[model samples]
Target: MEIPNRGKNIMKTLCLAIVLGGLALSSALQAQPSEDTVSVPVSARQLRIDLPDAYSKMWPEDYRDLVANYSLSNGQTLSIISRGTNMYALVDQGPPHKIVSTSRNNYVALDRQLKMEIVLGGDQGASGSVTMVVPSRSLSDGRFVPEQVVLLAFR
Candidate 1:
């Protein structure tokens, strides 16, 4: 009789452990990023850049952390947040514009009312990475037509 009771107790304990384990797994799965969380589709792709004649060495080196490369699919106003590396003149347009550090993490508006919030994989890797920001709105916009991020490394 005692042996049978012991076997029953062991089975009950095993069942409880299994049930608790499954509950924990379910909670973890729900905590993960939802499908709505947006992320850039490309990090390995390069960007096309057109620098004006006024590129200064101080410009690229000083603002290395915030500097980025960008391309325009349509001929429209490209608004970039004022950063140290933002120094660049328009191809036929004019000179580079560098603004205060206040704009460091702000929006850089590009064509089609599309805006960019700078993307550097990590703070440490930003200097070397050819990071750029594109407005989430333009992700599905019809104006820009490029198979992939265009590679335009003028540096």
Candidate 2:
């Protein structure tokens, strides 16, 4: 009788801890996007959030519109598809683009046509915009150079 009672008490304590932990986690996740969701740009397919491991992990079931097929500034349309766990960008008349690097809310893609690096991320300056950086031509000293940076944001 004593042994059974002790086991029951231990089980009860464990169950209580698990329940509390779950409640705390649920609240934290809920608070993340409610404040910013309204500010997301209309053209933006999804929140400018970094996947847990660069699409190596499945997207949350609650997220919608996992794919973004849009035209780049260079007049080339790139199609990026999400297979729930990973994303690949299909370049026009070129090979599929792989993720060069990734962070919490940003990633870089290397393109062959423009032969430059593109950075996509959330814009801290704008409440509901995405930041994009592409190559640009500028006069440096006495000659033209491709070191200029251009920022295109979607509001």
Candidate 3:
């Protein structure tokens, strides 16, 4: 009789433990982001950026009509089109932009968008990261203010 009661108590305890564990897992799953889209505020649309795969894959496949035109610090213009792993850029209808110089983590790109004299810095261990900056004329100072909108990370 005592052995039977002991077995019944063990089963009850095991059942309660399983229920509690399931509840914990349910809460954790609810906290994770959904597979389709990330949670972003409506007001942050300008700050919204598509994933790398979107730029590398979807842009080439579907959104190839979207052209990025950048007014360089110089007098020329830079036109960029997203293809695959490599981004193609044409400088004032000139030849394809090539890597002029490279450092351990930084590169000095001699293109119209990335002016030859400008030095771009990045976070530690960052490579091939491109950030889109939206420039607006300041009403107070009458100067161009650059606000970073989207950042795309590439290996």
Regions of model 2 farther than 4 Å from truth: 1-66, 109-155
Of models 2 and 3, which has the larger lDDT? 2
Q: Please report how far candidate 3 places residue 139 from its true position, in Å.
A: 41
| Candidate 3: pairs in clash | none
For residues 1-155, write the lDDT of model 2, one tens digit per residue.
Answer: 35565344333333443454465557556656675453333553321223233432325341223355545433444555655555555544445554433443344444322111233443532111122222233322554333222222222
> Which model scores highest in lDDT?
2
Tens-digit lDDT string for candidate 3 (1-155): 35565344333333443454465557656655876645444553243322222111233443233235544422334555554534455544545542222333222224423312222232432124433322232433564343333233333
lDDT of 1: 0.34
Residue 21 of candidate 3: its Cα lDDT? 46
* Backbone clash count for every predicted candidate, in the order shown: 1, 1, 0
Once fitted onto the true fold, the runs of candidate 3 whose alpha carbons sit more than 4 angstroms away are 1-67, 98-155
lDDT values for all models: 0.34, 0.39, 0.38
Error of 1 at 11 (Å): 77
Worst 10 residues of 2 by lDDT: 125-134
* Residue 90 shift from truth in candidate 1, angstroms: 4.9
lDDT of 3: 0.38
The TM-score, computed over Cα atoms with residue i paired to residue i, of candidate 3 is 0.23
Error of 2 at 77 (Å): 0.7
